[model samples]
Target chain A: MSKLISCYRGAVDAWECDQMGHMNVQFYMAKGSEAFAHLQNALGLDPARIRKEKRGLRFKSLRTQYKSEVHAGSALHGIAGIRKLDGDVIHGFIQLFETAFDRLSAVYEFTALYTNLQTDEALPLPGDLRDRALALADDHPDIYQPAPFVGTVMPARPLKHMFESSRSSVDVWECDIFNHIEHRHIVGYFSDAATHIMGSVGLTRHTVRSRNLGSAALDYYSEFHAPIKMSTPVLLKSGLMGAKGKIFRFGHHLFDLDSGEIAISTTVLGCYFDMTARKSVPLPEEYANFPAEKVLAKQL
Target chain B: MSGYVESYRGQVLASECDLLGHMNIQFYISRLSQAIWNMCYFVGMAPEEIKGSKRALATVHQDSNYLSELMAGDIIHMETAVLKASTKTITFRHRLINSATGDPALTNISTVAYMDLTARKAIPLTEAMKIKVNELMVDAEDEA
Candidate 1:
């Protein structure tokens, strides 16, 4: 087992926390993305050299699982290691720890392609860079194990019904300099869809607040299929996957309205929370029958 | 896979790019989500209808693959096809193409379920809605 590279260290800021009183999903992704760049630098792919060579990395896929909640003012330490190196693609994982609690908060797994920026073609990792990457390769199996859903391939099945849950046109404020929506906003869309779904299930903010309970995502897996242009109108669809005990799973699809294509797919596992206790709680009686796979099949 | 129906289109703007000089991952997700709303409207499930009836769709799972890089000033064209449709759920596949190159840049698969807001439970698709879904359905094998 190689040593884990200490890639990033930071703190959870007040602004990063959401209504659930913990750092939001987007912030986690942002930090993880930053750590990815740091890992590249550690592997000798310095930004200046990359730019000079007209070379860059494109993220092909990402999967994240939240194991514990991090609150504002919590100290954060991100450790990363190369999981695999295949020609132009780098497969890696990052573990985020809340130093204050001495507990792991999240894990991020990603696949990125090293490419020639001008031609947009993949390039093999140079020998020296590969050596550096290898030095940082570590499999800390004892400290972290991926969630069961991390790489689960969703079954391909026919749709019985589809509903358009939300619609919004991209605005300048919503985009970054790359001429596309930022990673945070992509997760934000999923968050929005989840909120809407919860609302449909009588788990709205008001209801949750009144009941002193809320919902929190335990795991989030998303894929970026394509980039959405600025000023484009986008659509969102959401639905339930399953529910058991206090855990509820859901999915979302974002499409480019004009082209009629899917741009992203996300799966989220969430749990009911007792806000005061800052811990998970059982599903409410009213929501106990919330559609599970059996109910969904029956409806179909 | 048979063939996709045009779903959405738009131009990449300077602001959408990141410091890396390419479109960010989030924008792709946003655009595709907008297209889904349009599809619902096309199938007669307008936002107003959903709101009035207190019925909504919720996402259960989504998977996507980014095939190519897209930059500022590029025009994006997206197409969508129904992969599967059931009484309470629908699965869809979307492909995004760069107008300039006419090559696919991304593909995504998503599954969703219909729900009754008041009852807070999954609901069956109406016969009318099911017919529209069937009309848009395409076999994945056909795309090959």
Candidate 2:
């Protein structure tokens, strides 16, 4: 089926799988996010230029359906089409299919807000882009007809962990057609959680920023036990796992608290430093008050 | 055969890039693990063999160093050799090499514990299997 805009091929590499030997869940978001980038570039929305122009597009919301599993060494193709466009926001629908069988593996329907890049404030969609997007939607009605997976059941039991922090909704400027949370946003979540825990110990965001992100290496892997779409109000839990010398390990998990399912679990490794001189920093007195024993007991 | 047989090949696909167009770091680990699987299969510890023997290999620790950039559609090979084999665990070293030039691309060292597949508990490596794997051990000088 042809849309005004259409499918792009993706290959499943060995690295996309988990111990279960299938594509990890977060990758659906990752791949879908990749497709959106291609779509935007095709639509004349150069994110770099937008960033340079200080006029950005952010994802206000996203919704996704993972109907099947993609395995290592498989080929997948994503088909996409725009649905509607208001002045600044664009709504779109996309499908990821296994090229081997042409079976639908995942579907995403999302809304994104255009924003003033410089101010990080929402902006109205240009009339020309809106018309182009609507014109594209009309080409793929059969596929665009909404078959969304609303109200799906959450895991019967919540997969809660002590050391996870829930994420806050993007403040309007972070939304985009890409749909997946931006890398900075993911890092910001941990930073916020660190601040929260630090705040409990009497350290403030201002005091911490003086050190900057000296050196941080985040190793994150999230299995898509299920799909989480945009605007789902997902819960994130984060806590410090351990700190030795200047290195600290943080663990985070994202949950669909409503369904009690663990959507993703992540671990981040970081080192504290002056960042200005590129040297390690000593643990602050506030960090001395960290709840270590309580945190280690919950590690999975 | 004196030792186990191992074979590996790197993935070549364009979709592996992240938003930055570089191979995302996390997926790199997954690729390394798969290479280890291929090495295991070459050594006669195929999935069918493991299933029949009711034994499994579970990773305990992994250490890796990335030397250079690897891109999508680049053909590479991960050559694996058993570094050490003991009663309960086996240590392995894997080198990711360019398929065309045969140059080292990345290095990974991992330890895996043998386990009773059914009970999911660690088990001792049999003498015969140990000897077989030792034959496949890459000489120390050849490791680099």
Query: What digit string (tens of lDDT, one per residue) describes model 2 on residues A1-300?
Result: 345444344446656564334565556665666566556644556444443555544555555555555666455667677777755668776678765467788777766776664444576777655666666654354673445332212222333345345555543233332343343344445445655555554567677666463333323323334434345566777666666666555556667656667655555555555645645576665556766555542433
Tens digits of per-residue lDDT for model 1 on B40-125? Answer: 54444644445254765667889999998877545566788888887798888888877556778899988877778789898888
Scored against the native two-chain complex, candidate 1 gets a DockQ of 0.04
Complex DockQ per candidate: 0.04, 0.02
- Name model 2 segments beyond 4 Å from true: A144-148, A152-300, B1-144
Model 1: CA > 4 A from native: A50-54, A86-88, A115-132, A150-158, A172-177, A286-300, B1-144
Tens digits of lDDT, candidate 1, A211-272: 89877888877666666767878988766666678877666677888877777776777888
CA lDDT of each prediction against the hidden true structure: 0.69, 0.57
Error of 1 at B89 (Å): 62
Q: What value does the lDDT take at residue A89 in candidate 1? A: 69
What is the fraction of true interface contacts found in candidate 2? 0.00
Which candidate ranks first by TM-score, i.e. highest?
1
lDDT of 1 at A224: 61
Proportion of native contacts found in each model? 0.09, 0.00
